[model samples]
Target chain A: MQRDALIGEPMVRLTGVAKRYGGGVIALDTLDLDVMKGEFVALLGPSGSGKTTLLNIIAGMTPPSRGSIHIAGDDMTHLPPSKRNLGMVFQNYALLPHMSVYENVAFPLRVRKLAEKDIVKKVEAVLDLVQLGHAKKRLPRELSGGQQQRVSLARCIVYDPSLILMDEPLGALDKKLREQMQSEIKRLHKTLGTTILYVTHDQEEALSMADRIVLFHQGRIVQQASPADLYFKPRSVFAANFLGASNILSTTAVGDGIAQLKSGETIRIGSGAAVINNEPVMILVRPECLRIERYDETSHLSAANSVPGQIVSSTILGNVTNHHVLIADGHTVMAQELTRRTAHDWVPGEQVKVTWAAADTRALEPDEMDVHS
Target chain B: MKETAASASHSTWITHCANAWAWFGYAFLVLPTLVIIPMSFNSTDELAFPPDSFSLRQYEAFFLKGDWLSSTFLSFKIAIATAVLAVVIGITAAYGLARSSFPGRGAIVLFLLSPMLVPVVVVALGLYLYFATLGFSGSALPIIVGHTLVAIPFVIITASSALRHMERNIESAAMIMGASPFQVFRKVTLPLLRSGIIASALFAFLISFDEVIIAYFVGRAGFSTLPVKMFSTIQWEISPVIAAVATLLTILSTGICILVTIIMDRK
Candidate 1:
């Protein structure tokens, strides 16, 4: 739906951006990025992974040590935050305790000396948008945490800035409220069509809300992609492990397109000229993609690779039961089931045969998957 | 019941000794102050702890004497000006020290607090030599300046600590929303530091108003502040009038303390 008006042009560009803190601590190292107009892009990473550093640099709160930044095609690297004209939401929901919700929302308008009627109208509109219309007369301390967060949102958006910087905006909320606010933020973004740069360490929040996710690791942008693309086609073991659970297995190439498991069982690997014969390789398959049972029941076994293992532990996660199995090679492999029908009732120490379709197994680089296999 | 009471009670001789000591301590402290208030109304020109007759002569002389009245007015001006100056400088510096981090910041903080740590004799000696070099020794200006300098560091420490727990996110949020840096500071930071600033101002005022050591070195004739004049008058003559002035100063300082407590309570 957003492809029509805004997706064609890049609204913000960070070219070779980098930042180094005091005592030679490098937060961001030569990071390059582009955010499309009207897109909600999440800068996702663990703490100290340069996500917040990127947000601060984009907000103009801090200057990059070694790169240029442009906003809507204008060079804004040297401008202060005042000139940047962006709205930001903080994790703490920093509303003024002395001010009523109405006055806090009107703060920006008052600063600009907007006409009193216009200020009133804009503040009312934003308050209604955040669903705090009834509580506008109350002070910040009187509001609940979720209500306070909504007021913070109203205050940030009343001015209608072109960009909104949110640094872990919902991170302080409990799980249920966070999920509710995720929908609220998504709905607001749909209506506003404003460029938003969100930063957070929570991967699920990033995956759920982002039009695109820029994943950072150790001061580097390890990968950037759509959630589905990052999940299914991760380029490295780091990506696979960080995004979700993956069981990587080591195999010995027996022939062209065929591989022998360390257990001496032969299975078909996808044929490619890149697949060198008799070469050692690490094969990655997601936990849920594996179908397993205590005994082999399949008649047509050629379509799938079968491995024999003993269940070490299994956890019942409502709809799915995650089984950790130990292979004959002393490697622990994880398998997940969709329903209780397959293996939820399976106890530890049960002999099991796990199988996956050959096409589902992605061969990761040897060095990247060394830890798993 | 009789046996329980005997068991709970302390030794009779020790209890009596403790009560006697407490009463004696009370008397020792109350003896001087119990005489001054009533003796201020003495009829005689010469003074004693106990007077033969009573009148309001000393009270009348307090206002009628040109030197005392002028000295009180000059002291008021100096104390007020010094308080304002010290609070402004101290609060700004303290806010900076609290909110910002830089190299040698700890040492800088210690240096600012050094005036409070050093002995008053050393401070008085330094003030004496410094004012004498400027050829303004025994003048009211040097004494006021010295007192302001000493009072400022106290204001700075109080305000800086207040600013540290200030939830810096308020300023950041204001900036994010469309307020300029100055607007954020004026509206958010200032209101939050109001209690600290008022406390600092009152404290600085009292510090300078009652100061004696530096004033002794720097105060001169024709411009003697109230405390300096009181000190000199007490040296030349220990009269009931000085005691009356001392009692008034005590009342004024007590009023300031009460005012500070009320303002802080409002916060």
Candidate 2:
């Protein structure tokens, strides 16, 4: 398959889109999003985060309560879904149970009143593209979950729509099948060069498949950036915890570039840290960034902050070992170390030191805890 | 080991007793219909069970009599019209009731199904009084309209149940793929609902065909339906032809019920 080299013009543009249901339940707050042609963007969020609602608005299935939508530079705010010329793949595949696979794939063309010959050719090509050519005569119930999803994909793309919206399309599949379909979808997106807006709650899926990830929280967009950028530098505490596992410690800024932990240890912050003196902040350290060593062996290490703690628990997870250590102030911090053939195993209640460079840690403003008094 | 064997034998005996009771229940329900079938074939003119001889004379009489045949034909026509009207109105009502949320949705559903909950004679009397004021008591329109009113509830029940089972996203998928609302209904919703609609139409036809109380009150002059005709005949005289008609109706209604059961099971 030949790839489209040039990134095309803007494919979808949403300005101040809002969706308020009856009784004043806000499914989507005022939000703006843009997708360049051929770009694969993933809406990543938990349930009730409005990612699915956002997708529905973009597909024109649900009218936005307020704001405007432009598709391919044409204002489509009031247009019905049929006028938008977009394809959507639902989570359950939603294959028409009464129709044969061939008819299901030919439905869009038939609705458009295309020539019969052209419909057959296009349907056949797309079915072959999804590798379901041999199953054309079978009904949806006769196929496996993965095959059903592929047929759904084939049906959506048969008309060569300018954009495709998929709402957790691989959610129903098992792990191995989900991974296979993810790669298959990515390959198809590359070859077809059609922009796609995917919605999923799985952070790993978004990280692996999307060109950019838009993180949503409670009906608002928290952050939108490339996967690597979001992973390495999350703008908010929610983004940091949601994207990956993080060990957060409550600390108070005591100096120009240092913070005092509750354990009374002063640690120098990295230049990249976003905090000021005398302000309460949360220090975030990735589990894998923390190294476990003996308390006495850390003296030779320079330019690294060390915390003395006791190993409370250790779990071996195939390629790495995760250890939970309790520090002086009764806070538990997690440290993950790669499992090598000759790696030493630390027993419970053994004294240990956790060390990491200042560059590996981040100090940011603390989030308001929503605790009930 | 002894206790297990003893309990197993006890359970087997219980199963045999249960099976015997089930067979007795079925016989109690169906034995009357079986008697009518044999009486329809009796060589004698009077109604009797276990006839000594058999003949098709009553079947021939049922087909050859002008009043009987015409009344049968009229009933079929009214039933077919009622079926079409009920299905058309019922589908839209079911769609609205199933897909949308409003303040009085539950109350609206209860009102639509009120005809079924009320006694059939009460509904029949109400229709008679209402149509009499309009000077339509003696016309076929009253019977057809009354039958449609009763049949609409069944159609709504069947269609709404089917709608509940359907995945709501299929319609949305069709719409997103550039199908207009009408096209989505035609190509997606209606096709998926074909069996349900057909079954409901069959129910409407059967309900109209067999309904006698409303037919008795509304049907007058020359517009009496088959059931009304049969009722009047049985009132003043005894005929084996009525037996034949009953047998035929029994078979038809049974076949339709079986078909509905099969369709429901398939889904």
Most accurate candidate by DockQ: 2
Q: How do the residues A24-108 of candidate 2 rate in per-residue lDDT, one tens digit apiece?
A: 9999989888888888999999999999999989888788999999999999999999999999988899998999999999998
Q: Can you tell me the CAPRI class of model 2? A: high
Clashes of 2: 0
Candidate 1 local lDDT, A194-218, one digit each (tens): 7889999888998899988888887
Interface RMSD of 2: 0.8
What is the DockQ of the complex in model 2?
A: 0.83
lDDT score for residue A213 of model 1: 83
True contacts kept of 1: 0.72
- DockQ of each model against the real complex? 0.62, 0.83
TM-score for predicted model 2 compared with the true structure: 0.93
Interface RMSD of 1: 1.2
Q: lDDT of model 1 at residue A174?
A: 96
